[model samples]
Target chain A: AQSVTQPDIHITVSEGASLELRCNYSYGATPYLFWYVQSPGQGLQLLLKYFSGDTLVQGIKGFEAEFKRSQSSFNLRKPSVHWSDAAEYFCAVGGANAGGTSYGKLTFGQGTILTVHP
Target chain B: DTAVSQTPKYLVTQMGNDKSIKCEQNLGHDTMYWYKQDSKKFLKIMFSYNNKELIINETVPNRFSPKSPDKAHLNLHINSLELGDSAVYFCASSHPQVRGGYTFGSGTRLTVV
Candidate 1:
């Protein structure tokens, strides 16, 4: 079974400050990790995803995440946060089976609500 | 064009009534999924279909049925809607091993009165 845990339920960061959201996962095999943001009344938008290789991956909206295999974590980071970056963040894990029948059956963690302070 | 689109973005109905939510993906992905986001913001997969074939069905109650008519559409119908069923339902599609293939539709907020 695969699962994800986001330790921060709510995080408040001042605008222009750096931000990091912690995510930990448990999977027996090579895991596919992703970060998604959902604004108020909007659907989820993929921030970044880690399939394989390259511990550091860059995503849209100036967000990036580092995949640390030893730590079993893929934490999202932003050098400088913007006010519009406030949203619900979710850490998810999924995998592609060898047969390739299904994918994106993600196991998501409890979302973290990000609040940007002016 | 919206890659993944769900109908009736907002739905409110009385308990014991039945309703359906329709979903379609124009991205040409063969796999589609349904997920439920509870009030606490915990998301869980409900069902998944591949090319109109049922592939994954979680512990969802039998009252909540999923139907995939074709490769592009997956519909969810709830019989005797209950208060507990009031939550946001999301439809997503993705192709295995394809970068940037996964896409999610604007969720349908169902409020059971």
Candidate 2:
């Protein structure tokens, strides 16, 4: 079974400070990792995803995540934090099945609440 | 235009009453899914349909049912709603073969009073 674990339940960072949200996963094979953001009273937006190849992947809103296969981790990072960047973040893992039928069946973590201080 | 849209962004109904939430995706994706976000902000997949066929069904109650009239539409109907049913339901779509990111709708907040 595939699962995702986001250790940090909540993280507070000052404006212009660097931010990093930790994420770890357990999968049978090459895992498909994704990071999503949800603003207040809004649906989730895809921040970034890592399928294969490069470990460091860039996403929208100046967000980036690095996939470490040895560590079984895909942590999201940002050079500077902004007040508008405050939102809930989720880390999800998907199986790399042969027929691609396991695409939408993602196992998400409990989510981490990001608070950006002004 | 919205790539994925869900009707009734806010729904309030009394317990024991039945209601339905409709979803539509115009991104030409072959698979659509329904996910429930509890009050604690924990998200879990409830069901998924591929090409109007049931592909993934989680350990959800039978009171919850899903219907896909076509490849572009997937609706969820709840029977005898209860207080525990109050949560945010999100509709999302993605193309599996393409291995791209999934697009999500604004979500429907169902308040079971």
Candidate 3:
């Protein structure tokens, strides 16, 4: 079973400050990692995804994530935080072996609430 | 046009009542999924259909049923709703070629009073 763990429950950062959200996963094989953002009264939106190749993957809104296999982690980072970036972030993991199909469903973490202070 | 759209953005109903949430995707993706987000903001996969065929069915209650008339549509029907069922339900679509990235709908908030 593939599971994602987002240790940070809530993070408060001032605007223009660096931000990082830690995400750890437990998977036997190479896992498919993803970071999703959910704004107020909105559905989850894909921030970035790591399938294979290039350990570092860049996503929309100046967001990027690094996949470290040894650490079993994929942490999202941004050089400078913006007020619009304040939202709930979720880390999800999935794999071909998850549901006996390549399109295996994702298992998301509890989510980390990000608060940006201006 | 929205890639994925679910009808009845907000649904408020009494307990023991049955309701259904309709979803349609214009992206023409072969696979569609239903996810539930609880009050604690935990997102969980409930059901998934590939080209109108049942592929992945999680350990959800039997009362919750999913119907996919076609590859572009997947509707969720809940029977005898309970307080625990009050949450936002999201519909998503994706292709097998695309690994783990799913395009989600705006979500339908279901409230059971």
lDDT of 1 by residue, A13-65 (tens): 99999999999999777888999999989889999999888989999999999
**Tens digits of per-residue lDDT for model 2, A4-107:** 99999999999999999999999887888999999999999999999999999999999999999999999999999999999999999886576644656888
Error of 1 at A10 (Å): 0.4
Worst 10 residues of 1 chain B by lDDT: B94-103
Model 3 per-residue lDDT tens digits across residues A1-118: 7789999999999999999999999987788899999999998999999999999999999999999999999999999999999999999888777355676678899999999999
Scored by TM against the true chain B, the candidates give: 0.95, 0.97, 0.97
Q: What does candidate 1's lDDT look like per residue over B42-104, in tens digits?
A: 989999988898988999999999999998999999999999999999999988553454689
How would you encode candidate 3's per-residue C-alpha lDDT over B12-101 as one tens digit per residue?
A: 999999999999999879999999999998899999999999988999999999999999999999999999999999999988644858
Which CAPRI level is candidate 1? medium
lDDT of 3 at B113: 99
lDDT of 2 by residue, B1-113 (tens): 99999999999999999999999999999999999999999999999898999988999999999999998999999999999999999999988642586789999999999
Kept native contacts, as fractions per model, are 0.50, 0.60, 0.58
lDDT of 1 at B19: 98
Ranking by lDDT: 3, 2, 1
Question: Over 4 Å off in model 3, which ranges?
Answer: A98-100, B97-100
Q: TM-score of every model?
A: 0.97, 0.97, 0.97
